[model samples]
Target chain A: MRIAVVGAGPAGVYSAQELVDAGLSVDVFDKVPAPYGLVRYGVAPDHPKTKRIALALGRTLGNPAVRFFGNVAYGLDLDLRDLLACYHAVVFAVGADDDRLLDVAGEHLWGVGSAAQLVSWYNAHPHADDSFAHTVLAAREVAVVGAGNVALDVARMLVGGPHRLAASDVPERVLDLLARSRVTDVRVIARRGPAQAKFTVPELTELGKLDDVDVVVDPADLAGADDEADSRRARANVELLRGWAERPTGRAARRVHLSFRLRPVAVVGETAVAGLRLDRLGVPSTVPAQAVVRAIGYRGAPLPGVPFDEETGTVRNLGGRVVDATGTVLPRLYVAGWIKRGPSGVIGTNKADAAETVRALLADADGFPAPLKVGPATVPALLRGRGVRFVTWPGWLRLDAYEVALGRSGGRPRVSVDDLATMLAVTRAGDL
Target chain B: MTFVVTSRCVGTKETSCMSVCPVDCIHDIGEQVVIDPVECVDCGACVDVCPVDAIVHEGEADDPSVVADAYRRFGLEAP
Candidate 1:
């Protein structure tokens, strides 16, 4: 059987791996010129360990039975009806691409940004805006409003010194901009206490590793982490928070305050973020800052022909099977990753999620009809007939090699090409 | 019930389990992470975090070949 997997992220690759292992032909599509969705784009540049998963994912895409079609977007390039004709099944593994808004008053201000935009900027994602660098460098103090790993990630990047990100994969220009940043203080504000924080213990404690940065934690906030600690990670986080709280301050030039039980009421500025107003359990206060990064969470947007849940920000599904609002299963359609469930879980979680979706698809395949238009030439011919500049697997390889060669001149791992024109030019030059 | 890193971890050497290992028994030699059975406290932390379900108890390994290959990759003699 032939299958089409949309979005070449962890979920799509993991699902493709399972299908190929089952001796089925799989074709993967992604909107970006390259693969490994968030790993290459959303993950922090200093996080080399987490980004290493790309090695395995790349291997899966390179398999004999699997083909990768990059630079092709769903809904725009091809709708659900188009894919359903050529393949036995289709799996949508598109990740959450949009940021969840805080809905505060001054969120429209010049300096008020989302962690998604900041991440895109540092990682050199094609969607990154040049103006984000200016905002970051211009701020003397930044408030990252959230408690999860994304929140800590922005906090770490903001307070990092000149030489802190030298060895990372961040573009030289972005690194230079960060080196000149005026941000000296970053406050990670959370509505709930530490025990209820979405942050994993390791990520939470990793903030302490920054060079000469004061890891500030309120002694009072440590109580919730200690008193109501429900899990092993919670307990461990409480221990680490207590250590930071007790440590002597004023030894460092930069400070990262881990403040709990604080809710953002407004961004508080006319044209730009001047400060963040907070409500501390009905007590009113404001933390003065030039920039605000809303890192509360990510929300999934509706795909071209997929049934989406507006409330939950997910593809409406019952264990990976796409269902309508009234709970009617749509045949031959599936979803995985952040799109399948809500935006949560680590990278490994996608494996189990994809497995269930694939299992259901396989079971349902027992009573399948014969495919009408299925072959290697079918989809390519269809896309070619329409004027889509779809990138082949070999094309992506050429681009990857060019990126690596560019980075090789410097000592860094790889310098990502953030624009589509350059990427297409590089790949086309190789005649792939 | 010491957790053994298996063949499922070969390609994806996610550091999720390694960073949380209390005894620091998990080591990324080259291809995959290996648990040092000698130092492992068998706390089951690695198993819970492993994304691919590659970790298993010593007695739960049904495929001896898979277990042996994982051990050999880590330069350990399979029991």
Candidate 2:
């Protein structure tokens, strides 16, 4: 059976991997000339280890049973109708790349942006824009609003310094920013107490371990907030946090304050962020800051011609089967990953997630109506007719090797061809 | 004996290995606080987080040094 997986991120690639292992012919499509969507873009550059997921995802796309159509966007170059006509079934694994807004006052101010944008910029994502600089580097202090590992990552990136970041696959320009940064204080603000934080303890511990950076926790904030160390993780987080609070203050250059029980009410600046207005229980207070990062959460955008839940930012699905607004299952359409569920869980979470959807899909495939279009040649013909310059699996490999060659290996991440043109040119050059 | 930190656990030792396993002391995944909330048949935590799901990608559980290094990443004594 032929299957089409839209998107080549962790979700899409994992879905495709499942299909290929089942001895099925699959085609993976992506907007960029390269694949491994967020693994290459969203992951923090300092954590070069996480980016290793790209190597495995890349191997799956190279599988003979799978075909990659890079630079071919789903909504634009091809739609649901086009996919269903060519393949028996389609799986949409598009991850939520859109940033969720803080929805507070003064968010329109110059010094506010999301952690996702900052991450994408440093990772050299093709779509990363310049606003990241204006928002993140606007002042000497950064107020990161959220309680997840992403908040920790942002805290690390902001003041972790160039010497620490240089070892990873970080882009040179981002490394330069860290080196020249005047930012000294990074406050990780959590609306609730530490009990509700989403960061895993070990990752939190890693943030604490950064050289020359002191992770300070206020004992008063812990007592002031309504905190109940209900779960082991929460207890562990609190214990670790208390340890930081009890420790003698260090003579570190930068400090990461794990502040809790404070909810951001406003960005608090006329045209740019100078302070963050916060509410502590009932008390109103403003904390000095230059820029603010909204690391609250992520939401999936509705793909064209697909059923999406606007509220949850997820594709409406039951056990991975696409269900409509009326709760009717849409046949031959399946979903996995963040779109399948809300943006939760880590990279491994998607594996089991994709497996469930694939199980349902395999069961339903026997009854699926065969595609009206025949042969592997149909997709290339259709795309070519639309003037879409797509990159094949081999083409992607050449680009991959090209990038690796351009990298300093142990130092800077491969000089990312942050523009689609360079990626397309690199892939096309290997075509001949 | 519970699972040993193998060479395969190199990169994501914290994110996947420690988090998923219930028995291991270095469970970073305790955001669920202890172990994976989702039930897995023979989940790696069974043997102290094995090469399954995210970590088992290339299945290179062959290197002794790499295994020790992965264990060292979390300050856990390698089996």
Candidate 3:
């Protein structure tokens, strides 16, 4: 049996590996020339340890039964109809890339940005513009809107000492910006009380231990706000907050204020962000901030010829089977990961998610009509006919080696190749 | 009894392990954190607090070399 997976990210690759283990040849396609979607793009560069999970994902892609087709966009190059015609089944694992907007006044101002954009800027995503680095360096104070892990990551990156970021996979442009940054205050604002915060315990505690940054928590925010959950994680977050609240103010050069029960009413500025107006207990208060980043969440874009639920920003699916607007299953079509369940969970979470979908696909295998005579070679031939230049697994390895070589002299890990043209060039380089 | 810090702790110096280490065996190297196996009491406090699941028992690391590397990183004998 042959299966095609759209996306080379954790979700798509993990599902492909599961299918390959079940005695099927799997083809994984990605828009970029490299694999490991978010692991390469979404993760904060300072947290290289978290990105290490990519090594395990890399091993899965190395399976002999699996083939990678990079630089091949699904909708632009081949639509859903074309996929159904060639393979017995197609699994869509394209993750949510767009950031959820704040929708408040002055949101489109010059200094306003998204946490995802900052993450991309640091990680050197090909799509992230180079100008963002200049904007980041110019800011004196930043306001991060949200209470989740992404918000904490943004806060940490803003106040992260130069020493913490200098050794990671951060690109040269971002490193230059970090060197010139004037940022002194970073406020992480949450709409709800401390107990309702979405940040994980480890991420929150790590903030307190920043060598040169002071973690300040308002004691009043903790009053009457009891942790609503029974889990150890909930208690951990509260305990961490209380610990930060008790930390005596120090002479730290930078400060990260973990403020809660404050909702952004408006981004107050005419042409660029100068401050923010927030509503706390129905009282309006203005806080000075040069930059505003919304870490609210991510929303998925609908794939061509696929049913999508606008409310959830997810492809319509049930037990990994894609369903149409009429609630009928779209035969031979399936989805997993953020596009299937909305943006949530860490990288390892995708393993079980992919496994669940693979089981459903196997259960319905008999119903899928015999795949067309077109085999593994057929797809590549078709792509070649269309004048598309795709990167194979070996091609990706060449680019990986190039990145590592680039960072070797600096005593850092691989320095990411940010531009698409350079990435394609490196992937095509001979003698890997 | 011994404890080891794997590659997962390289960039993420999640110090929950250090806070829980009963014998103060966990040491922060510049690039990564390490545990002194000789000083370690094997209290299992570090294992429960590692956010990345990077800590493991002496014999339980997915890569045996990672444990030795951790010891070498801290200039200690592999337990």
lDDT of each: 0.83, 0.77, 0.82
Q: After TM-score superposition, what is the CA distance of residue A130 in candidate 1 from its true location, in Å?
A: 2.7
Worst 10 residues of 3 chain A by lDDT: A224-233
DockQ of 2: 0.07
Q: Give the deviation of candidate 1 from the true structure as CA RMSD.
A: 6.7
C-alpha positional error of residue A233 in candidate 2 after TM-score superposition, expressed in Å: 2.0
Q: For model 1, what is the error of residue A144's alpha carbon versus the real structure, in angstroms, after optimal superposition?
A: 0.6
What's the lDDT of the predicted structure labeled candidate 3? 0.82
- Candidate 2 regions exceeding 4 Å error are A224-227, A409-413, A429-432, B1-79
The numbered model that scores best in TM-score is 1
The reply for model 1, stretches above 4 Å from the true place, is A429-432, B1-73, B76-79
What TM-scores do the predictions have?
0.86, 0.84, 0.85
Task: Give per-residue CA lDDT, model 1, range A259-356, as digits (tens).
Answer: 99998999898898899999987999999999998899999999987888999999999999999999999999999999989898777678778889
lDDT of 2 by residue, A1-432 (tens): 899998899888888888988989999998888888887887777666556667767778889889999888888999989999999999999889787888998999888888888888777777778667655764688899999988988888778877876566666667777677788899899998887888776568778788888988888866733357766567778888888989877799889989988988988878878899999988999989989999999889989988889989999999999999999999999999999998987776677788889998998988899899979999998998888999998888887777777786544456666777888888992242
For model 2, how does the per-residue alpha-carbon lDDT over B5-74 read when each residue is reduced to its tens digit?
A: 3333345444545433322233443222222121222223233234333332112445556445444555
Task: Work out how many backbone clashes candidate 3 has.
Answer: 0
- Against the native complex, each candidate's DockQ, computed on alpha carbons, is 0.08, 0.07, 0.06
- How far out, in Å, is residue B37 in model 1? 13
Interface RMSD of each: 8.9, 8.8, 11.5
Alpha carbon lDDT at A417, candidate 1: 89
Instruction: Look at candidate 2 and give me any clashing residue pairs.
Output: A169-A413, B3-B47, B3-B48, B19-B29, B30-B33
